[model samples]
Target: MSRFMSAALCALFVFSMTTANASAADAPGKAVYDINCSTCHKDGVMNAPKLGDKAAWAPRIKQGIAVLTKNSITGFKGKVGMMMAKGGHPNLTDAQVKSAVEYIVLQSK
Candidate 1:
């Protein structure tokens, strides 16, 4: 191949690899939850909902997914004892919080 063509091909390959790596790093909701919410939710600390504990989560789940997502994103005040906004992870986006909440609810159910 010509020098210019080779350089272009290499640039394309590098860009593709970078995009793939970024997507992989983004991962899914469960991973985000584990990293952020798990600190309290998993162990039931501070009255936070415990993962896979249907009894504890049933009423919250009953409130519906929309309510749950709203509370999660906006932060629950005096609900389920005490929950901070975005589970104290301000960097987490609303979509990420919703996904994490869904993952938690699914596991609880």
Candidate 2:
């Protein structure tokens, strides 16, 4: 094959691989939350809000997304209890934490 054709094929291969990796990484937030937060949050341990429990989540939900996201990322010790940094997952990106919070909020609602 010509050099130009080989280069094009290489580029296409790289593009396809990158897209596949991105999609794999983009697995739903609920899955992330289940793997991470559900340990405590699912059963309301340490006063962590239980999944799908709107009443338990109501007050925090009222605080709005921005505040909740901040708390989730930075950690907080509030009247309810302590939330660890990144919900104790230091490796989680801010976007991932936000997505997890969104999943929780959606389920709670």
Number of the top candidate by lDDT?
2
> For model 1, how does the per-residue alpha-carbon lDDT over 20-80 read when each residue is reduced to its tens digit?
6776477567777889999999899998879999898999899999999898888887655
Question: What Cα-based lDDT does every candidate model obtain?
Answer: 0.86, 0.88
For residue 6, give model 2's deviation from the true position in Å: 19
Which runs of model 2 end up more than 4 angstroms from their true locations? 1-27
Model 1 / residue 9 / CA error / Å:
16
| lDDT of each residue in 1-109, candidate 2, tens digit only | 6999999999999999998678647665776798789998998899888999988889989999889999999998988789899889999989888889888998997
TM-score, per-candidate, Cα-based: 0.74, 0.74
TM-score of 1: 0.74
**Per model, how many backbone clashes are there?**
0, 0
